[model samples]
Target: MKLAENMLFKYGSGKVIRVLYINPFTSIIYVIDMDSNRWSYPIPKDDFLTAYQNKEMIEENDDIYCRAVPEEELNELEKQKRDQAWEIVTFFKSKLSDDEHMFISKYRQKAMKETMAVFSISYNGLKNILIKYFKGSQTKCSLIPSYFRSGARGKERKAGNKKRGRPRKNGENAGVNIDENIKKVFKIGLNRYYYNTRKNSLKTTYELILKDFFVKEVIDENGVKIPVLNNVKDLPTYEQFLYWFRKSLNDGKREIIKREGTRVYQQNYRAIIGSSTQDAELGPGTLFQIDSTIFDCHLVSSFNRDIIVSRPILFLIMDVYSRLIVGFNITFESLNSYSGAMVALANSMTSKKELCKKYGIEIEDNEFPFCVPNRILSDRGELVNGYINGSIQNLGIIIQQTPAYHADYKGIIEQAFNQTNIKILPFVDGAVIGGNSKRERGEGLDYRLKSSMTIEDFTKVIIKSILFHNNHHVLSDYILEESMIENNVEKIPIRLWEHGLKYKKGQLRILPEEVIKTSLLPSQSGLITPKGLSFKKMLYASKYALENNWFQMARIKGNWKVKVCYNPTDLTDVLVFDEHGDGPFKFSLLEHLSMYSGKGESEIEQIKNFERELERTGKERELQEKMKLFTEIEDIVKEAREKTEAEKNYSKSNSRRLKGIKENQKNERLLHREKAKKEREMEVILDESIEEEDEFAMFRDWEESNDDE
Candidate 1:
């Protein structure tokens, strides 16, 4: 039979088949014999047609060319051939064209055998196969998907026309091709074929025919199969496909393929917030607290007996809940008494802004507000309580000293202090004792007091250092606290509670006041006392308590001695009556007065001022009553004088009424009338009044004489 001639298809001699025959008819391919005798034995029609049809098919409108190599260079040439084969196979699996895909799948298998013969078999082929099955037409290079789906189309065809937003095209059929039969049938157009078969041909063919073919599996150096043998068939039959998928997900071959895109080894980590089981026993501010010891690095000051150089102590209170440090203090001397504890409490209670300013740190206020710890847990060191048992009592915070020699109880802050002293500070040269001390000495012995490189500088160092340590140090393998917050991604502790709020839901949780109270009281824990509970021979207490019981505590000397208070309920209103209840033996005014009297006599002056006002008001009342009585008597006397003058009708009285008659009218008749009337009134009234001695009597008598006639 005469065949059509086409230059594009002609290789060495014979003319190729008709253009229409160049379809996915792979059944026609064969390795032909060169001898003329083969012409008598007619070429197998299927094989001949398969070879002619697939060869004639051109993809991307490109011509096929073979690279020629010398016989001696076959090994190297074979390697290049296998690599080219892998590329072609990958491209083939990506749904480029039906005829081209079939051609590549055939040659890729051939390349695999050749590669095994001449070089190490590359697993890239197997990777390409798996990617084809799973990744599918999800990539842009998948020609079938590119032809069917437009970039301007919405994610789905049924959706309404998209507005200004960019459109999405699905890549579901990326690495799969149209089935040979489906392609042949579709050559007639979309009119007559079954829609389901047309849509799913590529996927179906990939799963059945091409799935295992291109995945060239072989043995490795360890003699283990390349694609690990997981009996996917043996997985739970209930959800076999899903089980197989998961098994395939963990398959060795998939892992090998995945490894190619990344480095050979990498660390995988996740940091999440978690609570300690021990936290259940501890209250909000209960349990062991820790801090660093700032020794008097100056050997001279430390060695000297007379001139004392105080070693600053860092006191950290750990809130067992979130394993967070709730309160802390930096001081030259330790907390050994109530006063020091109070100062530490005051420092802790100060505003976060003040802490930030003193320490030179930036903190976010929203997340990490300054924390007020309910209790302080620390080592059995006097410094922790500021060397005064009563120091921290007034602040209403409980003081708990861990057992002697048990460092693990305070491990949280202890580890922090160790890191501060050993790791972080060591990076700084002056952080060492000698170095810091000399520098500090250059400033002065009282460096912290001057606010100028003296006391202020020392104070600043501590404040800044604590800030730096708490907010900047790494706490665990994954978590770090900048200030009061934990940060995992930035890998630094947030200096303020605000930054820590991201982890708030995890770490800082709120508990009711009753829970805290219940945990603190005797029926619950019975931990506190007026003299304070005796533990390891030390006394601790809540400040307002006075009863000496298992819970009541007192500050004696420098130690916190727990004097068991008989009553726990009488914390704020403990009444200390003397031997007799009569008069209540009140420790009121004098006792209250004596405490602050030495500081300044201001209280005494206030009392004196109050008493003077009281005396002045009393005298004024007496004078007011006397003045009223005198005024009433004057009114009665004036009435009587008028009555006598009217009844007498005397010529002298009429003459006296004239103006300027006072000197001329010294009438004896008027005087006799006035005397007789006065006598008659005195007899009627019988008025025996007490003798009146008035300093104004002379002035009154002179005015009276001048007015008289």
Candidate 2:
């Protein structure tokens, strides 16, 4: 056995390439470029003849003779020596039978024995050399020998330059260059008997497990040295313990459970009694929910003022407990934000008395109980939301912004607006209710003012109508049936009282006469006389409602208009003036009567009859007026004379004939009376005379007596 020629090559500058292999049977070792996959000097026939061979190579107990035998040596000609040697020999014999084939046949057997090729050297040296060779050379074989290395290096350099430009200088010292890519290696071991044992199949060596390590040597049951191996599975059967353990070393958790797989339970949140709920006992003016809605009243637009027809905004404060709309404002413009809405809210929040004094509205104490409201609740409209989010605390009012889009949060106010706008406003034909769209009929001034009536006239109509609605329209609690049942009707009752209201009982408190009398003052005594104020040539009541420092609240012009309501307990009484210290006028009930005028014969006759009645009473002025009325009537009849003298004469003749017939009837009546008197006298004479005188004489005497009488 002997070592063959060895070479070290550098493809580019400062790059060492080594080829290494081991012939285990011959104890021969080959060292070459580590980067190149090829061995130096075609490996060797054996290590017994290398320049580096020593006593260690010759005294090895492993089969060194296998490399020493010429017949067992490998030929460098074939790429694969085991199966292709015979094929290579046959090909050479056929192609070169002349001189080349004969020369090859003579030394083929010797070359085959001389080359028992393999890789050898320390793992570090092998890796370093391989790195250097691959970094510089393209072909693994080119890094093995000088001849192949020179040719391959030229081609790679030229190609690389063409592709990537000329090579640039890298700062590395050639002789002692360190390859950073080199990885550490471990030694695999086997027992002598197992390593030398005969085998039918190729065995792959498995890396040492716990079995290879002997923490401390121990004697077996038979006093033999033995090592320990932990064979039991360390985890539950469901999991791969080793796999999870290895991952846990890197990930810190043995079991990686995704958050998506975990269930999260949420807590139930209920309004707390002393917190979200009211702590104080509810009373009148305890709570008010302020909000705005578009009222349904529609009006026509005046000519030339035809802006985009818009529904007016109606802002109102409703008593939550009572469901009463306490204070409200009707505007012909959209609210847009909290500016106007807050104005309405402030107005609604103040007591009617305070408000009247402040705003100069003549509202009374009774109205105070009706108008003053407490806490305000509202949905998250921009105005309500802004108030809640901004400066509500400064106003000293509790504001609760209803959850977005949840109508039930402010159900009471919402329902109040609905009932007020939808139910009541539609009845008035030309009412322009604020907070409603103007798209429908009867919405604007053009529709409302087109009538003969003025805005003031329409205001009167609106006040009367709205009063009727408020007094007569039955209000209901704004709560679901389920809530009602849960509270056992107590919640509704409390809420109603807080809003300053009560539902009507089915039975009336008194008889119809009493009801009417109590409802309205008597016509004569204690009558509220309307002071005359002329408008459009017609005298109307001034609505001097607030008097003696008293306030009277009433709806005027679709708004809450206040006046001083007064009454004087006397018929034909005049309203007193504090400034003059005297009565203003003889304002009586007659002022309230409906005014009318008439024409034609029927009207004239009525006047004549009225004057006659006055004359009988001996009213001097009335009597004079009656005489004047009669004279006027006679003149009118005389003025209706027939045309032409012949028609006049005919009328006169007809009148005379009628007169003659009347006189003739009267004369006949007188003659009949005389005849009746004569008959009575003759009867008495015949009784006295009796049987004497003949029948004929008696008959003649009777006839004569009748004639004479």
Candidate 3:
């Protein structure tokens, strides 16, 4: 190839040389040994080219072979030396005329001596300046000082009996050198104090090393252990300790993890190399993040406004590509469960128009489209259930669960929850202010006491907030592609979503709403009885069961159980999947259990518990009443026995006592009838006298008034 100034070539002996200058008229080339900084004799151009062609000399493109030091990187002394060297080189170059042939050794030797005499420098020093100037592409940076080479860089210095560095200015003895024993102490101190979650400061760690390694403890006269420090001159200085500590850490990440916790390091210190959108190949509906958070505000029950319902769980599903909140569900479920997660997923894959309408929210038709994402990323919590994961996978949707405590994997949804809370919690009353920390006696009012909004009202508020977020909230930090920027697309989520649909290859899949709902809704086992299908202690009726006479057959043969699925938020109906592949059918609550038609699964369970408690109380009362009746019978029997014993003389024989039983019974019956008739006559006479007195009382008072008149 072409030969240029400062080009490096490797010789057969593995020696590298840099081209310095060339004489075109004389056809001679000049080069210098890069490693030794020694000049080589001039050679004819044809011989150099022949050597290069024969591979005896190979060209090297690596700049490190003969790299020049930048002038600005030099220190003050180095800068002065560079300037002096440059001035001498400039004066030497002026001695040769522009048209003169300077490749000859005779001319170079004569000019070098005159330059050395004019600059008051040695011949070798002046010659070295010229060589450096020519070797570094004839630039001023080539003359920079090489004073850094005086110190042994990247090489360990041997320790002597005397102190290694500069003497102390405080008139005190300098510390000892860091030998192998001191290095062992440093390792022990770091492992015990520095590289732990205790978070000891560096100075503190150094002090601890002094106490544990340099000092000795002994019992004093009072039997207390007292610490005694070694001589100051024998101990290593803090600077030496710090230097060795830093040098030992070749892998900084591992040391950081050791000092801090894994969670803290991963959350705050680790490098975030890629985005979820890029991971999904920038395709909309390709990846979705799902998570649940407890709403900060307490809500009231819809049926009874005075009843305070606890904080509801809010599940959010977000599209990673556009940062759009695709679907959400709000319920009074205290914890995240498979039912709540599945309900949220179902909402994500279906249209939100009807749901918004139910909450009295009107929106544009295309505001939030039905998005069935190909993959869902979530934490290893409720979504890790085998049944739910298996069912989702069967429907061709992948469920990816992140490792425990790594919420950043699903950061999109986590951020969405924070944004929603920031938008709504400030305005809502009864919202938890700090968290569930106990109030100091009477320091503050309980948030539960201030609750006023019903669950329905709270739901409506959430719906409006989500609608505003999807349509208006600006994604200020959203990264846009070139095409989107060219089209002048706004950073609003809805605009980004529309743009993605137009230009990006979407991974959205559409299945029938029923299919998705059936696949995602949580399922349970139920039994078929003569009355109806029993599920969660509530009977449900279905058309298929009635038509096939399953209940009647259960009465004759035996009860058979069937696997059914139902929504936990609404226990009004259960879905029974047909074994014959006829699809699932709905089972409504029986007419007698209409009161529980709209109750949640938790509410139904509470009702069942209350009924059990009531039955227990009734049993207790019934036992007391029965015991009272038995005590009365015992008292009557005791009285009869005592009367017989008090008579002392006579009890009639059995035959004699029974001889006139029928005649005596007839006489007693006649006496009893006459006595009852007389009592009725006496009651009638008393009623008549009272009625007559009441009827004439007004007339009697009138006659008395007339007499007075």
The number of the candidate with the highest TM-score is 3
The model with the greater TM-score, 2 or 3, is 3
lDDT of 1 by residue, 1-709 (tens): 2221111234344432212111222223212122221211123446544655676422111211111111111232333443354444444444433322333445445544554445344556443432332221111111112122224222222323232223324722112222334333332222222122244332343333223333346799998777442243221122322232332223333233343322221223211212222432322332324344554322112112233233445555444444444445444443443323333433343344644553465655322333334355555564342323222322223455655576676666666666546543443322344334433535544432211122234445555555555456554643433533323244343432333333322122222222222222122112232344322222223222343232222233322321121112112211221111111111111233332222112223334555688889988998999899899999999999999878975656655667566553667668888999999988766543322334467679989999994
Per-prediction TM-score: 0.26, 0.26, 0.54
Give each model's whole-structure lDDT.
0.36, 0.36, 0.73
Ranking by lDDT: 3, 1, 2
> Can you give the lDDT of residue 359 in candidate 3?
69
Q: Report the lDDT tens digits of candidate 2 across residue range 1-709.
A: 3211122333333334332333334443434444344433333534324422443322222211111111111123211332232233233334442311122324433332322222323444433333333222211221232222122222212222132323335732111111111101111122211232332111221223223431346798999986653323211111222322232222211111121111211112211112212421243445566677654444323221322223445676655444444555444445534443554554454444643443334545333334222245565573444323323322223455555566666665566566555654555454454533234675435444322332222333333333333344445433533534454444333343423222211111111111111112111112222333222222323334334311222222122211111121111222322221112222222344332121112222334455577676778777789899999998877766533443555546776757778789999999999999999999988976665556668899999999999
Per residue, candidate 3 scores C-alpha lDDT tens digits across 1-709 of: 6454556789989888877655555667777777675555677789999999899989876545222222222345555676677678667777876312244577777888888889899977776777666555454445655553444322455777777888889677678887777888888888888887787888999999999989888899999999998988788888888878776532466677987778777798754433444456445677888889888888876655776767888888888877888888777775668888988898888887866775678775468765667678877675877667755653446567676667777776777788888999888878888876235576877777888886668888888888788889988777788989999988887887877766663224444455567678877678888988888888999888899898999999989877677878778888775433234678999999997866677666656776788899999999999999999999999999999789855567877877999999999999999999999999999999999998799789999999999
lDDT-superior candidate, 2 or 3: 3
Clashing pairs in 3: none
Who wins the lDDT comparison? 3
Specify the poorest-scoring 10-residue window by lDDT in model 2. Answer: 63-72
Name the candidate, 1 or 3, with the larger lDDT value.
Answer: 3
Clash counts for all predictions: 75, 56, 0
Worst 10 residues of 1 by lDDT: 579-588
Q: What is the lDDT of candidate 3?
A: 0.73
